[model samples]
Target: MRASVELPATLPESLRVQLGQVLPNDPNLRRPASEAAGDGVLVRLGGHADYTTVTQKAALRACLRMPSGATLLIRMATGSGKSLIFQTATRWWREVSRDSLKPVSIVLVPTISLALDHERSSQAISGLETVRALTGDHSSEERNRVLLDFRQGNVPLLFVSPEMALGSLRESLRELSLPDQHPARPNAVRGKLAAVFIDEAHIVATWGRSFRPDLQRIPGLLRSLRAIDPEIRTVLLSATVDAETRELLRTGYVDRDGRWLEVAECMPRYEFDFVEHRFTDSISRDDEVLVLADVLPRPALLYTTEVEHAERLHQGLRRRGFERVRLFTGDTEPSERRRIVDDWRDGRVDLVIATSAFGMGIDQGDVRVVVHACLPESASRYYQEIGRAGRDGRQAFAVLCAAPDDFKLASRMAVGSTLTLDVAVERWLALLEGARRTEDDDPWSGMPQYRLDLRARGRHIANPRVGERNRVWNKSLLVQLQRYGALEIASSDDDSDGWVAVPRAGNDGLWDATTCKSFLTQIFGARAAEEERAREGIQAFKSAWRVRNDCRLRMIYHIVEAGAPELSACGRCAGCRRQQVAPPHHVATGGGGESLWPDSLSPPSATRLLELTETELARPVRWLDWLRGRGVEQIVVERRLASEIAALWSKVERDAGWVISWDLVETRSFRPMNVPTALVLSEKSGTELERLWRWGKRWNDRTHQVAWWVALRGTQIGTRSLQDEGAAGIQPPAHLPSEE
Candidate 1:
C-alpha cells in the first residue's frame, strides 16, 4: 500500500525538501522572538510566549482558515513589513505545502525601486528561483529574459508594475529573450504563471476616483489576470486606504464574499503615525528652492511636486553654501538615481532634489523628512508619498505645504492620464540616444528598444522621470525647463514642444554618445532604431507638463505628481510648518447640464444645461457639450466619458500650471523668443460665447485670447441654471455680472 501521508496542496516538490521541521504545531516551539531575524525574510513571527503584537500573529492565523477568503490585502504603513508577509508566504509554500512545481508565484510591484527591493528580499530565502523584476528599470534583454524564464518555469518569482503587467504583458512577452549562448532555451515561454502579486493594488480602483485613466484598465486587468494565467495567485498590498477601496479590491478582485485573503498568511505588522505641519509666506524666500533647508539626521527624503520648487530649493541650498546636495528627478537617469541613492547611503550627497519617483521601494530605513513644497492630490496618495519617511523605527518628518488651488489642478491631471501609444515609444527612444553604438553597420537599428540603456548615462540623465516608462517627466520637465528658459510645451506646433537640445557647453551626452565603443554599449548601443525616434518625440512633450493658470501651484503639483496632490492647504489656511488645518476653499463655483449633446447622455442638469446653452450662454464648448465638459469631471451626472476633448482641456488647465511656468501663459518665457506682452488662446476658447456675440472680433484677437475660453466656459456654464428665466428667449446668456 502507498505510504499514508498528508500535505497541503500549495507546496511543490522542489520546495518539499526543506519540509522536516517546517510545520511547528507546537506554537511555543517557534524560533525565539529575541533573535528572530526578520531581516530580508519575515521569520519567527507570531507564535511564541513573547510573540509580540508587532508580528500581528492572531490576525494572520485567523486568515489561514478563513471560510470565505481567497485573497489577502495587507494594508500596513509605509516601511512596514508588507513585502515580508509575501516572502514568508513564499517560504511556507516551499517548506510545508505539497504540489508539483514550486507553488509558482509572480510578484507585481508598482515601481522599479520596489521591484529591486523585492528582488533582494525574495532572493534571500532558500529554494526560490527564477526571481526577477519586470519593470521599465530593466534592459530589453533583461525583461525578455524575465518573461521567458517565468513562462518556462526557469524563474519562480517575477515582480512587475501594474502598467506593464496588465496593459503590455503580451507585447512584453513578444519581446521575450535569452542570452545568445543558451540555444537550448529557445522560445520557451507560453501560459505558465501561477500567482500574481499586485503591489500597490490601490491603483486598481483609486486611480479612477482621482482621474488616472491608466488605472481605469486596472479592474479589467485583475479579471484578465485570472483568465490569462490558469492558476495565478494574487496578493494586494497598500497602506492608509479607505474601507471602500478595501472592499473594492477584495470583492472586485479577490473574494466573492466580504472577506479578504491573507497573502503571506501573516498578520499586518505596522505602526502608523501621522505627523503634520503648517507653513506661511515666510516659509519661502525669494530666489530659493531652499525653502526648507534643515533636515533630520536620519536618512530622510524631500518630495517636491514640482522640479522648479526642487531647483529653487537646490539653488537656494547652494547659495546657503550646502554642498552634498544631490537631487533626483525624472530628468535624472536611472543610473543616476541609483548612484544618488547609493551615494547618500554611503554619505556622499547630503540632500537629493527628489521628485515623486524618488522614493518607491527605497528602504533607507531612517528617512527622516519628506517635504511636500506642494500638496498631493488625495489623502491616499499623501499617505503613500509621505510613508517614505520613518522606515527604521526612528523619527521621520513629513512636511506638506498647503496652497488653496492645488486640488483643482490635481483633479484635472488625475482625470486626464492615459497611456498614449506613441508617447510610450517616444520615451524609449530618448533613452536610447545616449547609448548609441557606432561600431554597428546599422547604427540606428542597433538601438535597444526595451532595455534601460538610459540608466548607463546616469549623470547625463540625472533624475529621469520616475517609472521612466512607468510615470515621470509629466511635471519635472516643465518646471525645470521653465527655469532653464526652455520653450513651454503647450505652445505653437512649429515650436519644439519636447525637444531638449544638449546644452552646448555642459551637456555630457555629446561626449558620452560620440565617444568610444565602450561608451556606446554603456549607454545607447542596444536600443533599436524605431525606439530611438520615439524618444525624440516624447522629449518634445516632456517640457509641456507645466502649462499654467490661476491655479498655479495646484496644477504644478498635479502635473508633477501625475496624480493630484491633495490640497492639504485647504483654503490656504492649513500651514505645514505651523500646524493649522483650514476648511477647503473654492472659487464659489457651480455648473449645470443634462444631455449636453444629441447622441450622448448626461446628467439631467447637464443635458438641460446644454440645451439652455444653445440659447442662453450661446454656443456649447463643443458638439459633445454636456458629455465632456468641465475638462476633468469624469461624472457628468452618470455618463462615464464621451470625449477626450474635455479631458485635454482639464489636463492642460490643471497640470500646465504646475509643470509649465507662469511666464508661458502670457509670453514666450525664453531667450530668442522675446517675452511677448500678449498671449494666444486656441480658437475653441471663444466658443462658450453665444454665436451672435461671437461675431465681435475682440475675443478672437491673440491679445485677448487668454480670457476668450475662460469667458466662454464661464458664461455658457454660468447661464445654465438661469435658462428657465430666459424671459421668453429674448436675451442670450449674458456674461454674469461678476465674470463679465
Candidate 2:
C-alpha cells in the first residue's frame, strides 16, 4: 500500500480527497515529457540519468519558444529545479543560436556567492565553460580579457552580481564596444545579446528598498541593453514570491512594452510536515538544542535569523554531541563557504546552521529535516527555507521553535529603520552643501568624498549597536542620494569607513539645494510608508501564526497564495496526528441536551459575539469539530450556514472585539450574539432531530443571528437554503439577507 493510502483519519475529509488524488503509489511525481524538443538537452544535464521534473521540462520548452524581447517569470517551488530552468533555458538558447558568438545571455545575481554557485554548476556541464561569472574578485587583467571577449561577442553565458553589472561592467562594455571602435574588433560584437536572466528574482522586490541599491538599476540597465539587442529576452526567477511581490516585480522590473509569461507549477511528490514548539523564558538554548536532537533526522538544516545565533547554535549542537554540524553564514570566508557547502552536499557534514545567506542557488538532495531556530521575518522566508528539505520525493519535516517574544522581535526587525532616515538626509545635505562651498570644487573634478564615520553616526542617530548600519540599513540611502544628482558616490570601501563621492552640478538639469531637498523628502517619505505597511503585515502574520491549528502546510500555502482554493489538512502534521491519537473524552451526545443552558443570562459583549461568529468561522471544519467535541448535545448546522455566521462575525469583530467559546458563551453570556455551533445530523433519529430543532429555534429567536440547522443529505455545504426551517432550527442570516 502507498504511504498516502494510510493518511490518518483526523485530516479534514476534503483534504484527504485532494491528497489522495495528487499523491499516487509512485512517489516520484515526474511527468514524462513528450520526447520532442529539448529532450537532447535534458539527456545531457548532469548525465542521461539526471531526473528532470515536469516543471523543468515545461519551463525549458517555454524558454525555447519565447519570442525575442519577451519577459518570463518562473516561480517553481524551491528545490524544484529553479536554477535548472535557467541553466536549461540558457543552454537551449545557445544551442538554437549556435551560429552567433556575440554574448547571448547576461545573468544577474544578487551576491558573489550566488554568482560562484552558478558558475560552478555551469562548469560541470561539458559545453558550459562558456558559462562564466564576472565579479570584483577577478583580477583586473582577467576582467578586461573577459569583457574584451564579451565585447567581441565571444562569451555566450555570463553570470554577474548587480554591482559589477551596473558599475565597472557597464563602463568597460561602453569603452570596448565604442561605435568608433567596432571595426577594431569585428569578431567581438557580432550577434545581438539574446537574453538576460535574473535569478533569485525575489531580491528585486525584497532588497530593492535598501540592501542592494544596485538592484533598482536593473530596469534602467535592461532598457539601455534593449538599444543593443532590440529583441533581447528577460527572465526573472525565484523560489518564493507572494502574489503582491510578483505584481511589484512586474511594475518595477518588466517594462510595459515587454511580453510577459509566467510559469508556475506546484511542488509534488514531497510530503512536507511542519511541527512547532514554543520555548519559554525559562528554557535555554541548550534545552532547545536537546529537544531538536531528540526529534531531528540526520542530514538536517537549522536556520537562524542572525549570524551570531547560528554560531552559538552550531557550538551548542556540538557540545550536545552533534559534532557533525557546522556553520554557514555571510561571515564565513569565501573559500570556507565553498568548502562547507561542498562538504554538506557530500554528507561529510550532517548539518549546517546558517542565516538567509546560505540556501539560495544550492541544492542538496536527501535532506530529511529543517529546523527554524527563530521565527522568520515573514511567512515567505519561512516557506522557502523549509522547501530545502524533501526535495528527493521523500517525507521530511520542518520544525519551527519560537519563544513568546520572537514574533515581536521579528516584526521590529522587519519594519524597524535600518538607519535614522532623518539623519541620513541631514548628512547628505550637509556633505553636498560643503562641496558647494568649495570654490575650486570643480563639478567636473570627479566624484567628491564623504569621510563619514557611519558607525559613530549610526550610534548618534539611533544608538544603534556596532555593525547595525552595515548589516541593517542606511547604505541604500547613499544610493538614493546619488540618484538625486546632488551627491554622486564613487565607491564604498571598508578601508575608508565611509564613501568617496562627487557632487554633481546636474548635467541633467543642475542639482540645487531646493531640488535635492525635494528629492530627499519624496524618497524618504515613500520609504517611511513602505516600512509602516510592512510592520502591520508582519504583526498580522504573527497573529495568524499563533491561531493556526490546521495543517502547517496549508497555512504556508494560504500565506503564499492568498485566496487560493482551500486545501485539506495533510493528515501528516503534528496537529493532525495529535487529533488522530487522542480520542475525544466527551463528544456532544445525541439526546435531550436542548435546555442545557439557563434561561436568564446577560447579553454577550460585541467582542465575544464577533469572536464566536467571525474569528471562529474561517475554518468551518474546526468549528464543527469544536462543537462536536464540546458538550453541546444534538447540535445541527450546515457548512454554508456556518460560513454565513463566520462572515457576519467579521463585521461584528470590526465593530467589537470578538470572543467565542462554550465557557464564555455560558458564563459571560449574550442573548442576541450567540454563534450557532454545527453538528452532523444525517444519522440522527427523528426524535433527536425534533429535540435539536426545538432547542435551535429557541436559541435562534433570542439571537440576532439564527441558530443551527440540519444540513440535508445531497445538499452542497455552501448552497443550502435558509428557508428550510421545517427541517431544523430557524434559518441562519445570510451575509446579505432580505425579507425572505
Candidate 3:
C-alpha cells in the first residue's frame, strides 16, 4: 500500500519524503454525501458535488441577505475560496432580478495585475461573461466600450484599480444610484448598483497613507453612493487583517448607525515548511542564491525589496544558464507585466524575480517555493507574499535569506512617508487657500467644497522643482484629515491635478489655528504611534528570523496572529527536523465552524426585503420619526432588527447622529456619548430584557440628571409587564416583526 501511493511528479524529492509519511492509509477519506451537501446558491453556482467550508457558507448567506449601509469584513486564509462569496452573491443577484432591475457590482483591486487576473478568471464563471477590467493599460476605445456596457447594464462584475475608481469611473458609479429608463420599453426601470467589493483590502490601511492615497478615498466614494442609494452594501476581503487595519476599516467604512459583521478564520497556513538564513553581506547572499537556484523547486518566486535588486538577480540567474527566469518590478511596462503573468501561469516561466508588485490574487496553484531574497517591510506583507505558495494543498517551502542591512531597509521603508504635525498644518493651509480661490462648494451637502490644487506650495518652500513631492504630501494630508472625519473628498479628474472635497459639518472651523492645531496633533500623534508599532513589528520579525533554536513558522505565526493560542510545531520546519520529530499523518487546511444561520432560519432574500410596499415602509419610517421627535439619541435593538431599522432611519436622517447598538448582552466598548441622549431599548428576549434593565439602572445611577426611555417590542418581557413604567410599546414593521 505504501509503495502504491501516488504523488505528483513535479514535487521535489525532499517534499516527497516528507509527504510520504503523511499520506493517509484510507485513500478515500471523503466526507459522506449527506454531510458534504452545500447551500443551494453554492450548489447551483459551483456544482452539485461542490463542498464549501462553514465560513464560506455563512459569509455567502450574509452577502445574499446584506442590508443597505452594512459592511462585511471577511478574513479567511489564502486559497480558502474567499472569492466565492462575492461571485455567488453577484450571480445570485443577477438570477433573482433578471426580469426586474439588474444590479451591478464593482471590485476594487490594489494592482492592475489583480484586476486583469479577476477579469480573466470571471470569463469562465457562468453569468459573469460581461466582466471587464477598466484600467489605464486599456486603450481609450476599450475603456469607452466597457463604460458603454456598464451604462447599459450589460456589465455585471467590473474590476478596477483605485485610481480608475476615482478618475474615469466616478460618474458611471454615481449613475448607478439614479433610476434609468429602459430604452426598449416605456416606464421600465433598467438597473441599480448593489454592492462594492474591495479586494486585498488591507492595502487601504497600509499603503493608502502614502503609496496610493486613492485607496483611502474609497470610503468617501461609498459615502457618496449611499447618499443616493442608502441600501448599497460594501464588502471588504483579504487574507489577513491585523488589529490596526481592522480598526482603521471600522472607522473609515462601517456606518455609525449600521451593522458590522466580521467573519474571520484567524489561523496560520500549515502547508508551509519554513527555512531561514542570515548572511553577513550581500556578496554571500548572492552566491548562496546562485547555489540554491539549481536545487530549489521549480515554479518559484524570488522576492526583492527594490527594482534594481530584482533586475540584478534576474541577470545573474540568466547568465548562469537559467533560461526560463524572468524579472518583474514596478518599472515593468504594462504589456510586459501582463505577458509575464500569462507566461508564469502557463508554465513557460520557471522563476520570477519580482518586487511586491506581482503575485497578488494570482491563481497559479502548483507553486512549490517562495524565496525571499530580502526582509519584507512588515509581518503582514511577509505573510501575504509567502502565501503565494502551496495553494494546491501540497507541501511547499518558504526560504528566507536576510542580511543586517535588510533590517535597516525594512525599518526605513516602514516609516518613510509619515509627515510631521507642523508640515501637515502648513500643507493644509496652502491647500485650503487654493480651494478658496477655486470656490467649488458642493450643491447637495450645502458645504463649502473645493478642488484644491495638489501642486500647491507653502510659503516656506523655495524649490520650484518639487511639485511632485508637494502633490504627494498634499494628498497625504487630505487623506489623513478625511480619515479623522474632518472632510470628505467627493471626486477627482483624470489629470490628477486636484480633488473635490468639503468640510464635514461641525468641522468647518478646521481652518482656525487653535482647532486645526488640536486636530492635527491628534492625527500626527496617532500616526507616530502607528509608525512606532510598525517599527516594533519589524524588529520582532528580525528577531524571530535570527533565532534558529525555535520553530520559525511558529514564531512568525505568533507575530501575525497576535494573542492567538500557540499552534503545534510544524514537524517539517528546521527546528523540528533538527529534533527529528515525526511528521503528522494529516493536516487540516480549510476553516472549520458551524453555519452562522441554520438552514431552517435562513435569512430572507435581498429581493424580497427590498420589495417592501410603501405602506410597509411607512410604518418603520413613522416609528423612526416619532423617535426623532421624542429626541431619542441612542437606539438599542436586537441584532436581527438593527440593520432593517437603521436602513430606514438613514433614509429619513442623513447625518447619522444617532448611535445604534446591539442588545446581545455581551460586554462591549463604545465611544463616549455626551449629548442629552435618550436610550430606547427595543428588545423581546427575556435574557436581553434583563440585561437592558440592569444597564438602565446602572445608567441612572451614573447620570442622575439625564432622562432615559424604554421602547419595548412587546408588552411582556418573560413573565413581567412594563405597563406601569410609562414605557411606550413600539412594534416592529409588519413585514419584519421580532422573532419571539
Candidate topping TM-score: 3
Query: Pairing residues by index, what is the TM-score of model 2?
Result: 0.61
The whole-model lDDT of each prediction reads 0.38, 0.54, 0.67
User: In candidate 3, which residue ranges exceed 4 Å CA deviation?
Assistant: 1-36, 98-100, 181-191, 434-455, 462-469, 484-486, 492-509, 562-565, 578-740
List TM-scores for all candidates, in order. 0.45, 0.61, 0.73
Model 2: per-residue Cα lDDT over 1-740, one tens digit each? 23444544543354344345433433432222211112334544323322233345446545655667777777665666667666655655655554535435778987666777777777777667766787655778988888777666566568888767776776543333334345544544653466779998877755665555667656646655554445678888876567667776675455446467666553322356556656664145335555555445668888888787788777777777877777888788766776776787668988888888776766776777788878887776777778778776566667777776677778766764444656665655544454322222323343333443444343345544556544224446665554433454444443334544445544322245456555666656766766876776676556555663445566666666423454555665555554553322221111111111222333422111111333334344444434334322222233234223333332321111111222212322211223333333332235445444444445555652332333343322233333433344333322211215
Q: Count the backbone clashes (under 3 Å) in each candidate.
A: 91, 19, 0
**What does candidate 1's lDDT look like per residue over 1-740, in tens digits?**
01122433333332222221221121121111211111111223211221122222312322222232245555444554556555545544443334333344566665555676677656665545347766565688876666666666566667766556544463332222222233433454432344455677665544543233334334334443333332344556665344445545554455323234432211111111223222234243222224334423334566666667676667777878877887777667666655666676566765676666566755666555566655554444555676676555433444454444443444443333432333423433454454333232211122211212323222334554543432233322222222222211111111112222222223233234343233333323322232333233223222222231122223223322222225323222112112443323332110010101111222222112222222333322343233333332221110112122223223321121101112211122111111111111111223323332332223223222111122223333224422432442222332322224
Give me the runs in candidate 1 sitting further than 4 Å from their true place: 1-69, 96-100, 128-130, 171-192, 208-212, 228-231, 255-259, 262-291, 295-298, 318-321, 344-350, 403-740
Q: Output the better candidate (1/2) by TM-score.
A: 2
Error of 3 at 272 (Å): 1.2
Better of 2 and 3 by TM-score: 3
Clashing pairs in 3: none
Query: Cα RMSD (Å) per model?
Result: 26.1, 20.4, 12.3
* Model 1 CA lDDT for position 567: 38
